[model samples]
Target: MHKNDTLNPELKHAASTESGFTLVELVVALLVISVLAAGAYSRLANTDTQARLASLQSFKATVLSVAAMAKGMCISDPQCDIDQYQTTSSTTIEGKPILFTGRYPVGLAPHGAGGLDQLMMPGKFTIQPALSDTNRATYFLAGAHDERHCKLEYSITSAQSNPSVLSVTVDSSGC
Candidate 1:
């Protein structure tokens, strides 16, 4: 054999054989991973938003029920009776306090409007005081379900001129 062609057949075969993942295959895998990650992120964000909305709806219901309870207490005239600001709850917000300004806890039997006199998490709620006075009285109830997680507040505006304003707002401070 000529010196220039001295390589063994097995050695030549080995050199010709390729090894490792293809660039195309690696790119495809990366794309799939990215897509899956994006999908997971999107799902998480949507779930968070839904949870917030549900909590808000619950708060709205609580406000309405409380209003009804107050109305019942003053069957003759609810306008003048809902003036008292009562704080009854298991928490506090903005250093104020959480309170239940309703009557009977519930109307008749079902027990309570929300199974509880107040709809608040412990250490998370407040009722703003009314000093000046206006059409009725307003209270700002705020609290957090978790630190750096779910901080929420209710703008409870009770007025004789306009229907009571009950609003709930939430911010992510907890998970």
Candidate 2:
């Protein structure tokens, strides 16, 4: 074995090279990181989606409640409007409430559609007049997400209404 040399510097270096991570160790590390990242990304996307949906639902409920309050006060028109309804806006929806945008008006529902991704997506909310003619104002809200990456949508309908929700859907394809 010593025929080539009494002492081999190359041999010493090779032995030292063997000190850190083995091939298997490196591969395993990579695999573990990949798995962790995948899991994290998935959770993040789902939670964000759910939160968005919840907010939409909350907004819907808020609209309904505010409408009821407005009704109780016997004021859906601009005549008996107050300060909050005229000046302040909702922080979550539009940064600032749309002024004179009646918090909730009969047949005055706002339509909202957008993508809500806290970590990696643009959070959007669309508010448009509801497409129904119910005396009680209704807001149609839709949280649009990366069709291939997120899931966020919530619908509101009266228990005594028609077309009894033939289908209600929620998805997280983006994940």
Best-fitting candidate, measured by TM-score? 2
The lDDT values for all models are 0.43, 0.39
Off by over 4 Å in 1: 1-21, 76-125, 130-175
* TM-scores vs. true structure, each candidate: 0.41, 0.43
**Per-candidate clash tally:** 11, 13
Off by over 4 Å in 2: 1-18, 75-105, 108-130, 134-138, 142-175
Count steric clashes of candidate 1.
11
Residue-level lDDT of model 2, residues 1-175, one tens digit each, is 5664665889867876776878999999999999999999999877866776675555544444543543334234444354323221222222422212233222322334211111111234332334233122222334446532332233323243231121123343432
Which candidate number would show the highest lDDT if scored against the true structure? Answer: 1
Question: Model 1: per-residue lDDT, tens digit, 60-155?
Answer: 466556545444544333433344334222123234222333222211112222312233333223332231122222222233345334434444
C-alpha lDDT of candidate 2 relative to the true structure? 0.39
Cα displacement (Å) at residue 100, model 2: 18
